[model samples]
Target: MTKVNVYVTLRESVVDPQGIAAKDALHKLGFDEVGNVRIGRLIELELSGTQAEIEERVKKMCEVLLVNKVIEDYSFEIGEVAGK
Candidate 1:
């Protein structure tokens, strides 16, 4: 099995309501040092395939369903499973 770590974030120009809310909440909690907190998602997928194949498939998956290309950006890391 291979593990793919997909990280998805909003484009810098896009406004993130969730991120803003969280930052505001943090500030209310006395965390004034936190600034411009941008929210993102981490998607982990496990599959069996060669590294190249896995990367190709995951990239397609990102383009099709895992990311919103118009407002978001993404990056991924692929690696072998620890015990597989």
Candidate 2:
């Protein structure tokens, strides 16, 4: 079995409205030192498969449905849990 960790976020060139909002809120809360905030999604998936299989599956998921490559960026890692 393997555990996969996936992350999706807007590319640096893309504008993030929610991030802007958070930055503003931080300023209002007296955290003027906060410059920018970026938003992203993290997904954890457990699968009964080898590490290579998990990588392939997550790669396909990222390319086909989880993310839009043109405007966003995504990365994932696969790992085994201890002795399992």
Candidate 3:
């Protein structure tokens, strides 16, 4: 089995309202050290395939559904899970 960790985040040009709200709330709570904040998503998938096959499938998955190409950018890491 292959473990895929997908990280999806808004593009730099896009505004993140959730992140802004969280920052504001943190400041109000006295955690004022918080700077510019951005919100994102992490998708963990366990797939059965060889590394190359998994990579191809994951790329397709991201392009087809997992990520929004217009405003979001994504990256993924492929790894092995021991004793699976």
Candidate 4:
């Protein structure tokens, strides 16, 4: 089985209100070093396939369902599952 880690994040040009709020709260809590906080999501998927096939499928999945192409950008890493 192959393990895929997908990361989805807002484009740099997009405003992140949740990140802003979290940063402000952190500052109020005295974490003064915090700066330019941005929030994102991670999705882990496990599937059985050759590397090339998995890559193609993952790219299609991202474009068709996983990622928002307009406001967000994504990246993925493929690796072997442990003890598999």
Candidate 5:
């Protein structure tokens, strides 16, 4: 089997209001040393399919449902797992 790791984050040019808000909230909550906070999504999948097939399916999923391409960018890594 293989394990795929996906990371999704906002593009550099995009303004992340949520991140700013989180930083502010953290400051008020006594974490004054905190700086910018950028939030992202991570996903892991275990598949028994071939690498090529998995890549194709993952690309489709990213374009259709996993990410908002207009505002975010994503990268993924796939590797064989030690066990089923």
Candidate 6:
């Protein structure tokens, strides 16, 4: 089995309301050092395939369903499962 870790984040130009709210809450909690806390999504996919095939498929999945290419960016890491 293969383990693919996908990260989806808002573009730099996009406004992240959730992140801003979280930062504000943190500041209220005395975490004044927190700054620009951008929120993102981490999606883990388990599949059976060759590295190249899995990479291609995961990219397609991101483009088609997992990420919003218009206002977001995505990246992924592919690795083999130890005991799968």
lDDT of 4 by residue, 10-34 (tens): 9999999999999999999999999
Instruction: Let me know the TM-score candidate 2 reaches against the reference structure.
Output: 0.86
Candidate 5: Cα lDDT at 81:
70
lDDT of 6 by residue, 55-84 (tens): 999999998999999999999999767466
lDDT tens per residue, model 2, 1-84 = 567789898999999999999999999999989988999889887776667777788898889998899999998877666445
| Model 6 regions more than 4 Å off | none
Error of 6 at 72 (Å): 0.8
- For 1-84, candidate 1 gives per-residue lDDT tens digits of 888899999999999999999999999999999988999999999988888899899999999999999999999999667566
Count residue pairs with overlapping backbones in model 3: 0
TM-score for each model: 0.93, 0.86, 0.94, 0.94, 0.76, 0.94
Give the lDDT of residue 19 in candidate 5: 92
Error of 1 at 73 (Å): 0.6
Worst 10 residues of 3 by lDDT: 75-84
- lDDT winner, 2 or 6: 6
Q: What stretches of model 5 exceed 4 Å from their correct place?
A: 80-82
After superposing candidate 1, which stretches have Cα over 4 Å from the reference? none
lDDT tens readout by residue for model 3, 1-84: 678999999999999999999999999999989999999999999988888898999999999999999999999999776456
User: What clash count goes with each model?
Assistant: 0, 0, 0, 0, 0, 0
Residue pairs in collision within model 6:
none
Query: What's model 2's lDDT at 76?
Result: 85
TM-score of 5: 0.76
Estimate the lDDT of model 3: 0.93
